[model samples]
Target: MRLLLIGPPGAGKGTQAVRLATHLSIRHISTGDLFREEIARGTELGRNADRHIRAGLLVPDEVTVGVIRERLARPDTEPGFLLDGFPRNPAQAAELDGILARTGSGLDAVLHLEVPDAEVISRIAGRRLCREDPGHIFHVDHDPPEVAGTCAFCGGELYQRDDDREATVRRRLEVYRGETAPVLDHYRGQGLVTTVSALGQVQEVLDRALTAIGRAGSTPRTP
Candidate 1:
């Protein structure tokens, strides 16, 4: 099933996206990965996108749309794909519709993971990352490291990134609310949105998401 997954940063959308795509046997596509792939391959579009990114500016819609267009053209997407972090606003959503319309196809559903702003702040602000290895992430509440203010792996200093600071996280939440509200509203008008609570255990959320989408028995099921 062609699907769009939308949620705030701390809503565990990334984890759910991977699980849903795996269970459904579909590609899990995120714009950040796409951009990284492009930049790593040193393509012209990648260079242009990199320039904008280096300048701390949003990549132009045309560039972003082009990236998605090329990705969707791949043979792998023929079966299905779970999209994340694309079509960030209504304008991009319209562009996505045009792209799919050309091929006589469109999204089957848009899964929205709902999380309260207070919870979002708590979840993000407590995050700590290892300076030596960004992958070594720890949460003050959910998963603290063996030693406080340090990473279990590599013995690196664990620091809360500026992006994860309370103030910055709030700012990000505000931006998400302002931009994605209209996109969600637009999808609701088209009757393609499925709202799901993004709380509880990972397995539980995964089950809930699958059940919510599969109520129509539309998406393929894994054996």
Candidate 2:
């Protein structure tokens, strides 16, 4: 199914997107990941996005929309895709509609992960990461590394990101409330949104999301 995943920062939207996409054999597209890849490559788009991302601000609509269009046009996305961290507000949602309209396709569902602000703050504040490979994530209180201060994958030193700090996480959450909440309402008004509780274990939350979508007929179980 072509789906969008929307939630506040620390909402585990990325985790659910990855799990759901793998389970359904669909592509998972994340604008955050896209920006990171581009920035790593020092592409024009990446350079433009880097400054905003570093400051925990949303990338401008034009740049973000262009990147989403390019990703949706890829071959791997032909079957379907689980989109995470795009269409962050009403404006982006409208732009997404235009992109889909041009492609002669439309989104099947929007999975809205709902978690309380306190839970979100707790989850993010305890987060840690591998300095050498930021992709490797851990939680200091919940899921620490095998060896303290070391990554299980590359032996990289584990550290906390400035963006993941308490103050920064709070700022990100505030931005989500101000900017992304409207996107959720837009999808809800279209009757295409399924709200799933994202408060349990990662796997439990994933199951809840799948069940919610399956009941909505967005995902069909295969024999």
Candidate 3:
């Protein structure tokens, strides 16, 4: 179940990645989480990435690819892994192919979660994250917390991330359009791209994703 999940900022790729990884019993490798971990530890890579991230710029491909290579070499990835957020452009996509080639492994499918730009803006603008755990996410309209401005899972304040701000999200969307969209074509050329709509309830989207992947000829592992 080696898969790459790609989508716009508010397409719910992160949530689906976690669920798909669990369903397939594969390692879930999220570049955003990886960057956060590195930055929290103040590693050299993190220090470098921090500058680009804070400036609302994409991290250099070399730095991003280095981190990914290290991660992909780990034992857990030997079986399979679900990759999210790393290959943001065609160059990184090609670099990923090179990295995997060294290990004689490659992606079975690249899932593109398609959502309209307007929907993306609406979703991201309403999204909030828990102070204690960013994983505890909620949307003001779609999935509000029991108490407004508070986390449902934990009694913590909920705040919108800077990246989720309307202006910032628009900028991010521009960057995605300029850089990341080509990666889809790169994978499509390999016949490894699967398109799925990102709008729907969580389970509904998951089912669509699963069906898409299954049609690609890969089945999730039994729990």
Candidate 4:
């Protein structure tokens, strides 16, 4: 499926994207992961994105769109892809439309994961990441490690990310409301938007997402 998954901080967009992509056999194309990969490689785009990311600001639309365009052009994405974290505002949404038009492709569904701001704050505040692998995530309340401040997967030190701090999470929510929320409206007008509660167990949420996508009338492509 060609999907765009939207959610505020702590809404588990990354986790859901990974799960959904695996189930549908589509590439999980996350802008956050793209930026991290670029930064880790020390590419020019990564250097530019790093500065904005460090300040808890959205990366510029041009740079973000450029990266996404390059990614979508790749052969692996021919099957389909689940997009996360790009098109943060109406302008970028329009840019995406234009990009897809040139390739005769467009989103099949846009899933908006809804979670209350208070819940988002609480979820993000307790979150921890492994120093060795950011993928090894834990929540102090919901998914704590066997030992305090340790990663269960890699035995790396686990610590809360700076962006996961309460204040930063609030800021991120503010940004989402002011910026990302409108992108939902942009797609809603196209009759391609689906709203799903992001609460409950991971598998439960994933099931809801799958059902929502199916109801939206886009069958997953056979792998």
lDDT of each: 0.90, 0.86, 0.90, 0.90
lDDT by residue for model 4 (133-171), tens: 999999999899999999998899999989899999999
lDDT of 1 by residue, 1-223 (tens): 8889999889998899999999999999998899999999999889989999999999999999999999999999999999999889999999999899898888888889998888899999999999999999999999999999989988999999899999999889989989876789988877788889998899988888998788634654221
Q: What would the TM-scores of all predictions be? A: 0.93, 0.80, 0.81, 0.82
Q: Give the range where candidate 1 is weakest over 10 consecutive residues by summed lDDT.
A: 214-223
Q: Give the poorly placed runs of model 4, Cα more than 4 Å off.
A: 39-44, 50-57, 128-140, 143-162, 218-223
In model 1, residue pairs whose N, Cα or C atoms come closer than 3 Å (at least 3 residues apart or on different chains), thus clashing, are none
Please say which candidate is ahead in lDDT: 1 or 4: 4
**Residues 1-223, model 2: lDDT tens digits:** 7889988888888888999999999999988789888889988888888888889876899999988988888889989999988898899899998888787788888888999988888898888888899999988778888899899889999988787788888888888889988898887877788889999899999999888878767454221
The sequence of per-residue lDDT tens digits that candidate 3 reaches over residues 163-221 is 78999999989989899989999989888888999998999999999999998765432
- Listed per model in order, the count of residue pairs whose N, CA or C atoms clash below 3 Å is 0, 0, 0, 0
Candidate number with greatest TM-score? 1
Error of 3 at 194 (Å): 0.7
Question: Which of the predicted structures, 3 or 4, would earn the higher TM-score when compared with the native?
Answer: 4
- Deviation from native of the Cα of residue 155 in model 3, angstroms: 11
Model 1, total clashes: 0
